[model samples]
Target chain A: MNLARTTSTTKGKECEAVPSDGKPGAVGVDPEQLWLRPTEPRRGRRPSFSREAITAAAVTLADAEGLEVVTMRRVAAEVGAGVMSLYSYAPDKETLLELMVDHVSGELTVTDPPSGDWRADLKTVAHLQRAHMLRHPWLPAALTTRRVPGPNTLAFLEHVLAVLRPTGLDGAAKLEVFAQLTAFVAGHVGHEIAQAAVSRSPDRAAAEGRYLAAVAADGSHPELAEALSAPGRPLTPEATFTRFLNRLIDGLDTD
Target chain B: MNLARTTSTTKGKECEAVPSDGKPGAVGVDPEQLWLRPTEPRRGRRPSFSREAITAAAVTLADAEGLEVVTMRRVAAEVGAGVMSLYSYAPDKETLLELMVDHVSGELTVTDPPSGDWRADLKTVAHLQRAHMLRHPWLPAALTTRRVPGPNTLAFLEHVLAVLRPTGLDGAAKLEVFAQLTAFVAGHVGHEIAQAAVSRSPDRAAAEGRYLAAVAADGSHPELAEALSAPGRPLTPEATFTRFLNRLIDGLDTD
Candidate 1:
């Protein structure tokens, strides 16, 4: 579902904020500058650190300590570069975030081309994303914020687009499918991590179980009570993911 | 899909953090206490502010200034209560957040019981959730953290269970369907809000467009190029939500 509504109130504000460049809502880095421009050092003394090195350090920091710890100063320190030198490459935290996302996206290499069974291939794409996001728990949050794909991210996107090629859906539908799939994976992974954290404590687990049981015993919630009373399956996260993913992809329509 | 994996590495730290009370993550209000026990003021004197009034103030502050500003001090000031006094009801920010989520959930009143067409009814539930989250931009993030359905939240969950009753799925599946649906809505609305914010800036929009155009022209990205070159439809958020929701719900298999 397209949850983004183009309401009149929002449109009014957008109109006033639109810059005079005849470009509407083009507020972030110019894609031309980000994607096409070379990251050459200024014509001066030799550069101390590469953009790739800085981004790798940031990603490493985020993986260990979460995204909040990956500040410009901290990232510079992580790579043993001066903050000023770091700015020459990323300019700001936002740019660094973009760089970090793409740097990690290099991990998403598709060894097999689309299997012609686009639905099956799409599921594989989603599985890869779920695993990737699990490895980088902060990714779901990073992704929800605005980002323009760097070369590595674009490469993964290209692979996804190829996976959807045989579906015969128009380009827009294909793009929407990919976006929806990614959102789904991110959302699921985020929930999974939170749940995992809670599930670790037996005391917490027992308390939660008791609470639900008590709720079921309460007469007012018949349906809830019934549902709680039924036998449950393995309820493993992977199984749950597979079940939900199958429903989502299988239900996709080309028209 | 269940995105949360049970990674053993995380478990070691969690075990250490488990509290001695045999109720580790029971750091939040005990569900039994919250859902069942009354919030009676201490025996000696009357409470200066009702829990509802305090929660309402928190919700109002959140709706206006966003969640970050709805701290205990700010919320206490908003309701003209002392910070210490506010603690009598919601002991901390997490508790206040639980109250706020349920406080707003009072808006989700399902007038009709679920129609026999479970899929159609489930879609309706999702639409309601999407609209609800769009109204409160901070809600998606709040939901991601943690929340046990206080009375208001439980009421909505009860209705969702009723709606899923005819699916012939067991209770666990029904609960899962509801959880997945909520997660999907939160994820979509969160992305929608971010996109809308970016769309308001002409420079950012133009930059993003140019980046895509450049990518389309680059020969390595044939599938992406084809997708980018293809003519697009209205691409409104509501339409997109409906399309994706249909895919998700329609694809759901009970087995």
Candidate 2:
């Protein structure tokens, strides 16, 4: 995460991929290389591995280990291919990342057409995204870096656009809305994941609860204390997601 | 980056930190150890550095470089102290991260009292947060981990709670609202930072534009093509942030 990579109008998180040389790559990928370039299979004798198989292996690795461990060598080894051979399939770790992203995105099957109630449909979209990210725990992080939608991701985006069709937003606003919604879901889910981990330990949860209690007892934090003491609805993760998602999608104004 | 750590209620992204010993620390930190634990000044001599100084040095390193480089050794070196001495200030990188978060959070000063219009004031808070993240690009990543608020973070949270006071929300909901808003801002700014880096490279931007055009040209993605072709408002980052923030805060329901 070389936060120092700066240019005019710069926005977003730094690239997650660390180069083998142990240096951060320039903040973003070459679009032509990532999107425009076509993958060609070897024309010689039949290749031992397919890009799909390689990408699946990489996804499995990330799903099992984490994104950082999805190096070409490990991915190639997982697929029983030579390290050099993997390049024909994924060129570089960054490219593999693109593949890994698209691979998991296939799970987001938009079987139901948009219900035409765009807000409800958008809520469903958020729910699906939350579930999808839950399944692929690395997804929220993967999406944070600069990504070009592959076929699967583009398909999902198309579905979201369809859901927003009634909003009468211009093409760009629709795109922006989709991007915003996805970011909101990812952010919520990421925090949810972290907090869930903390809650798993009774000691830690108790400690946090106690700490909040103590803070509330202290006179300076009257608002915080009052809030904690107030009776509240059960904030199951799903319920929390629904509340926030409604605030976002229902409040959206095409104008 | 450990995407694999799972439990019964496992939902989203995994832990960002990997323990050196290849074991997950018993979930979360004890609140007492984190907040209430007193730092005993070394007996031998007057300490040359304050906790504030060490945290500031770490924040500087993260701001200039990135979060990955703000190690104990490097932070100590930056502060002109021995590596061992740094531990007296920050027991570990996690503690240092908590400190770094609070340190940068000091910038979120709420000088103006909350306006009677809570929605508008909440928008201001979001705007302040977005600007803060832009200044410290490392903040979004830092926020993803489980953080215990230090003095600075709590002060800001207290201000947010005060802003939400008119909403008639009990204490927990106010806290939830604050957390949700912060996460949203961090998520948006993180993406904004990433996108800004991509826009810096005209070649890459053009390639992305062209690729989208080609995708839109293809018959399969009609909604996508239509959306892309539509004349849209100029999406300046600030404008985008305001648009989304309004949807979130305005749609917020206290009941």
Candidate 3:
């Protein structure tokens, strides 16, 4: 929505106070309305309710109890406000998630600026994207982002694009490369995080372990069994991120 | 789980007799149990519930209702059986899902197997992987597969490793490449599927239309905006998938 105008209910006679029934909600200058920050808030004061506060609360709930528990009323209550008040900022739970997506996206650092080497540059960018998603595992489930690339996301895309520019690929190819590269990194990280959550369940993990032992008992799939048994090198998003980047770069730029 | 020792209650029934229970539970078969037919009161039977049947039912649920809804009770309902009885075949829902994962992975076909041309071979394998995930969007979400690859998954990996065989990369390097490639392909498909789901949402589609209108108003972030608005080509998983595979291949393989 129109994000330019933010409202901050007046500070009243008591400092550090927010009026429940006061003026328009606190909004900020974030025009994308990406974080669902209030539309009109003056400096040095807290709004009665805010998108950031709600999302933070939701994130906490999700991290602790899993995503299924992060409902609208629950998040609203967490923020010490009514569902209606929370709605004033997030409008709906899905919208609140979108805001959360942008909020988490903002945590990634673009760089002092992207370096010029397309290969090195891309590796760096991939690592950062992985790091961003890892910090907010809830983000992987928010796979379908609308065309609204928030400020932070815009920056991330720009930085990657900048790195690719020096590689000598034209806009169309570059766009395709960038899109594929990102999809790989994002998809990979999402799998890892979600899998970890599922595996963390004792019943599930135990069952999986037994199944593995049973299946491998006959050694029918030796390569497979060895793979299953290997104390494998742990792959964070960064390493997998880099490896995929290499694969993509190696696959592209025959020039 | 005593997988091999499992038995199907459908055996030993007479050909023309009506089912005794009238509850219409699936005649589940643990073929490993070798209880091909029950004794005494054998009757005519409907199709039996194998792990594959349960897995297919689970996949169908996930495809239609999203992953969260694919619970044990729901899957049992779909299979026309009691929830507790599912443990005989699936042990737990996670194992059931693992069965589903392997079952779905079984759908992938790498026809020529892997060739010495690692780049070309990997490219071929990559496309097959992409196609499989694309067909089943819920797959990438649940394919947690940590150490032991399932039967179908292991075959796929074995095939992938064979492709890397000619790359002259060592075990660790080959493993990394394999992991990276799978992650990349899986991750990319995950995004595409997630986005497809998003576009399917009326509210999101409406919000997106609004977001696009806003973007048009601002007339900034030209590349981002262009990428969003351009009608250059159909936005399909196939197009992006191929592009990404090429990019990764180009980025790797200095040989």
True contacts kept of each: 0.51, 0.57, 0.21
Q: Which wins on lDDT, candidate 2 or candidate 3? A: 2
lDDT (C-alpha) at residue B203 in model 1: 69
DockQ of all predictions against the true structure, Cα-based: 0.33, 0.37, 0.16
- Candidate 2 per-residue lDDT over residues B111-188, each given as its tens digit: 899898998888888989999999988787777766877667777888888889989987667777887898899889
Ranking by lDDT: 2, 1, 3
Q: Is the docking of candidate 3 incorrect, acceptable, medium or high quality?
A: incorrect
How many backbone overlaps does candidate 3 show? 48
Looking at model 3 chain A, report the run of 10 residues with the lowest lDDT sum. Answer: A21-30
lDDT of 1 at A57: 89
How far in Å is the alpha carbon of B54 misplaced in model 2?
Answer: 2.3
Q: Count clashing residue pairs in model 1.
A: 22
Displacement of the residue B227 alpha carbon in candidate 2, Å? 2.4
lDDT of 3 by residue, A144-248 (tens): 333345655655675666676666555555666666666666667765664564355544456555665566566554544555565355555455556556666
Q: For candidate 2, what is the DockQ?
A: 0.37
Taking the tens digit of each residue's C-alpha lDDT, what string does model 1 give over A125-165?
A: 99999999888877877886657777778889999999888
